[model samples]
Target: TDQVQEVLEAAGKVYTVLKIDEVSNLGAARIRVRSLLAALKDQADREAEAAADAAAEKRGCPAACIDLNNLDKLVPASFTEKADGVVAAAEVEQREGASTEFERVQFTEEMRDAGYTILAPQMAPYHFELLVPIFKRAGYNAVLLPSVDHGAVDAGLKYVNNDICYPSILVTGQIMEAVLSGKYDTDKLAVLITQTGGGCRATNYISLIRKALKSVGLGHIPVIAISFKDLGEDNPGFKITPKMLYQAIYALQYGDLLMMCLYRTRPYEVEPGSANRLFDYWMDACKHQLQRGVRQSEFRRTVRRIVEDFDTLPLAGEGTKPRVGVVGEILVKFHPTANNQIVDVIEREGCEAVVPGLIEFFLFGIAGGIFQQPIGKSKKSALGSRIGLAAVKKLRKPVNDALEKSARFHPPADIYELAEYAEEILSLCNSMGEGWLLTAEMVELIRSGCPNVVCTQPFACLPNHVVGKATIKELRRRYPESNIVAVDYDPGASEVNQLNRIKLMIAVAKANLAEKEAEARAARDAARDGAPEDPEPVAEAVEVETTEVAE
Candidate 1:
């Protein structure tokens, strides 16, 4: 009773203690507990709905007044004012047409064939490195831009609002800096940005890029929007064909496999750069195969060869080492520049880094559409989302199968399984940026034997705060042995402070690992001596009853 009361207090749930006589037997006590929990859950739900209603009212947009069907038409008046300085100028340029000598040029199929270069920002080096070769093979002069740096951040800050998310700033800055550097012919170069078409501010990134380009007197250079949705409907020239989409998906899967292999082998390799060299070899081989128009049937063979190659690398002495899993915002979690090379830092600290596969994110986007069906009025919209998800799953099977067959790598969890893990803790309807997917990744990491997790989020991502930070206490309650820390990355945040916190987590990981090893050694020695083994005392498990609360 005391333990249950303490847990309720810690979770911030208000409950009155029941007299012992009032709950006379175990069954009666259980019934009382269930009733109290139900009441608390109802109270929480009511409060959450009231808060949401209040927020909507304060914003002066009634729930019914906002059209979910068309997100572009629902921009509030206040948002328009905040974005006017940037968006208005771009809109003026767009309406003026190229006859007025506007700098922005649309990238047509003709431009692609005419040797026009397209630059894409680099988020994950290994993934982008492999992905670039596929683009080259497809006859698109696509180049992954250089790593983000202080210069990119400065350039981003100059044109972009500082209050915007850090990734937007870095992406805009990297492109603008590249353009101004005279690295490519101004007439033939274009920049590509992704449009999520969601409620999050990320949907505004394409607009931000256009505004920045116009401000820099480079409005003539086309800003291509790459998205699965109809957000880029106006850009007919930058269309993605079925073959191109198929190839890109395979490239992403291959990149994920290589990244996993690299992280698993690099830390303990006898030669410092052998794993990297082999990685480059496989990348080149895969690119050549892709160029030759290798059939999907050959993908499994390719995966096997790549795994066999990595297996040949000489590894140094290794026992169980500290394993740290990284989960957070897409850009900061994978980009070295954004997170200050966190994976490298973890490796340097003698730990193996485990990052979830990028395919999971694509799956998350598909899942989001399905999750939102309940809120939408159109059955057609729900049907479209179902069809889209089914097609993606069909396409994903070969890649998943290949990974599962590989002996040296860990297979990614099925999308449904990930969603199930998330459903256990968070509501499926919470489809914000990353949303339930972030929580699912944390659960996946803990279950996969990497309990020490570093959740890296940009300083201003609100979705991350709700899904990442807010869910940690509940996660800890369920997995008491989890060693987790949330690290915020921003221009103003101190690197020293981030590193210090990570160091502390690492210290705890090392101690726990040492203790486990000691216990194993003791058991083995006792068995070898042919003497009566001392009985090991078992620790009592603490039962923490918790109700799922949506944020």
Candidate 2:
């Protein structure tokens, strides 16, 4: 009886806190109740839609928002062939299928033989799930193991002596969580860590991982340091097989294509899960084709077929819309972590959401270095410039090709001019780091027809806060009618708060678009300008905030 009383007390308090209706009149109270019920109904509908999308994703069709079916095979067979050596090593380990100790010894030996260079903070498109595919495509026989999570964070808290970055903790936590999940075998498993050799405590992440292994009594496992600093592996040499590179690049290209398709289709889908269903089918097809050695010509043919297939999807939305561009920190902008599904929110609001590919992040990072060093073009700096430019062209070529071939989808001009357009922006925002670059990108997005830009970033991320917050004023000043908003994510933030902010931003964007169209109409009448009239106003957008945090 006492326990029941206690439970009732708790429930009552909860209801009291949530029931914020302070209407003084019966009419006001009725309106408030009706609005609340309507909001609840809308939420339930969205949940049902998401659930339907998830189901469609499971059914091996395209995801309602994205498709991966037909991407140009970005990585050629040659790259996979080159990665054969690495695969051979992993095969040997599996074949030896020996005890954990033996496998560890073998792995160590292989690492030393190939001179496995660990890239510090070695982050990639596919962290763990896609590592095998990436390695296979890259023609490398490498295994990516999650490093110490809790241990690394604890170590960082102790010795690294730096303000804790959320990524570091999340990465660590993800590893730790995976470890505890018992899905991974720590034995014979060598976790790869990147040591940047920089001032950032990020350099210590590897050491922390090592320490973590020891603390967890998993010290026997090898810690492979993937670095660009010519770090030597004594136990074994590490080599990249051509195949792994091919798979890695292909996977990323496919990911990009999928992202692009999803963004394009989502804004006006009739059936909620249609885009996602196609994505699943496309992934399965890509995997199968890669395994079967599909002909290059056939590959293009397959993509065309898939695009035709997607185009045939009967899904339709309510209205014509303005496409908005979303650009910001890579994780926040793309990951639900930072933006709380801002892209989806924008789409739901009856607008096309354009998110640039991950390649731009890489391009910006490289360009940042060159701009930072004025002497980059000198004889001594010639090698760096050559390398940077080569990388830019190499990475950009496929993207450019994809865009060129895309009939239904056209990437914004800013994306085509990414490397070239980034130069001046880099110079102007050097003080703000990559955040400033992201802001500039968002600004460029607005300038290039995406009247609305949303900068998704972590709350209190110094670079992001400075760049995102400060650049808004400049963006609006330059593009007076620009609709811009920065959504911040942190552990304790409420979904309601986040959604409310985004809704407000979208409202402003809608208002601005309306005013612009009105002005254009007025101008059209005055000048008899043969220009076409403006697009009509869209229905109010439905904004939902559901950003997932590591916790």
Candidate 3:
């Protein structure tokens, strides 16, 4: 037992050194290693238990569901096959002669009468096009808001408190400002926002925007929160129709695939705007397919054609530019609510900004539901079914595959591994949400390959604070060379304060790079002198010490 303790101590020390020496992201790496180790142990335990269950079943006793509370069983194969059948049957619901012609003509008249204009978040062109017809079908004028710009951002920064993400303020500001500008009647115009009610600032954005409106005395205007879930209870009630939900989810999946391809091709193209242009063209094609109710077979052919076209675009940007991986609170990471025009800021700093999409978060949510332990007979019986098991597995695969594929390009850290780390953290804390995973992503991304990370959360957001505040120390201890900054956005946070903090983080990143270069130079000189390099030893340090250094 003494010898075993010594071995563990030795392994821990080596783990610390290897983690620190190879990457500048200490928090994510340490968390990742911890998670991976736990996952390995969990997997071993599951396999053994499964084997025992299989043997018991062979002896004629039926295999009982594993503790549903502990492990989310995959949906059984039978369910997957049945789900495929359901999907196929639903495809037949597409109308061959669905007449939007009458609705379009009527909407055009209503728009002229009410002076109503539709506003959508600045989404990929593909998404916008698909959404436009849907909004039109619902009876409104719609256009994707222009990409966020500096002037609009500046105005929003002036009014918005420093603590809130800048982009949300600007975009909301733009919408509000547009209403006030008399370009459209205040009574006739409305803007749309999406709500997930998930673990992020996005869930609260509608309230923030509404409050902002009230402050500006624009309280009469309607702000629509298009929810895929039951998020907003106070606002203008909009029940999601089955047709609407189906169309919206399909649009989301289609947009996700296109965005993935666009980013992948953008970095390697030979002609600037080729990818963007193809994206535009594909959006039109996708809209046509969806509107005409084209079969899946036809949609696949169109996607293939789009992919081929994307390959022809030129990669115009600097290929070797430093890449900054952004993680943390899902909404803030993807939506502007958390990060405050961070992608633009990073681009201005001459770095490529990579953000994980919404699909992964959705997968997390669904799988999280499955992971819930069964409380009674219903849950146990449900878990015993093959369909339930297969459903969970199917949902999990896309996210896992995407994570692994994304790692190949950016290679900073393993987020999936970090998920387990977060799971363990939640297990210990008896909690789960965007907070635990967002914090874990910070540690994982840094460990995987990205030392520079910006974690955005809402001011006074307890869960996010719990995840982010403690990471400062862990980050430093594991990656003394890593650069991380947490930005909290609210109506009152000053822009200067947020930017100043980011500036400091950037400076640290630069210094870390400089030190790395110096070390390489020193190694080359030592080699010339026929001297051996001496590796530094590792030590166990508390989170506070690292945070102090960062401070």
Q: After superposition, how far is residue 344 of candidate 1 from its true place, in Å?
A: 0.9
Q: For each candidate, give its TM-score against the true structure.
A: 0.75, 0.61, 0.54
* CA lDDT, candidate 1, residue 75: 79
* TM-score for candidate 1, residues paired by index: 0.75
Model 2 weakest 10-residue run by lDDT: 537-546
lDDT of 2 by residue, 116-215 (tens): 4322222333233334544444334444443322343343333222334544544444444444445545553555554433334445455555544555
Ranking by lDDT: 1, 3, 2
Best of the candidates, lDDT? 1
**lDDT against the true structure, each candidate:** 0.78, 0.54, 0.57
Which portions of model 3 miss their true places by more than 4 Å?
A: 1-133, 137-144, 149-175, 186-191, 196-224, 228-239, 257-272, 287-295, 298-319, 329-332, 335-340, 371-418, 424-433, 458-460, 475-482, 488-551
- Model 2 vs. true fold: TM: 0.61
* Distance from true location, Cα of 465 in model 3, Å: 2.5
Candidate 2 residue runs with Cα over 4 Å from true position: 1-107, 110-131, 136-163, 193-204, 211-215, 219-221, 225-238, 241-243, 289-319, 337-339, 348-350, 375-402, 405-407, 412-416, 419-436, 516-551
RMSD of each: 20.1, 27.2, 26.3
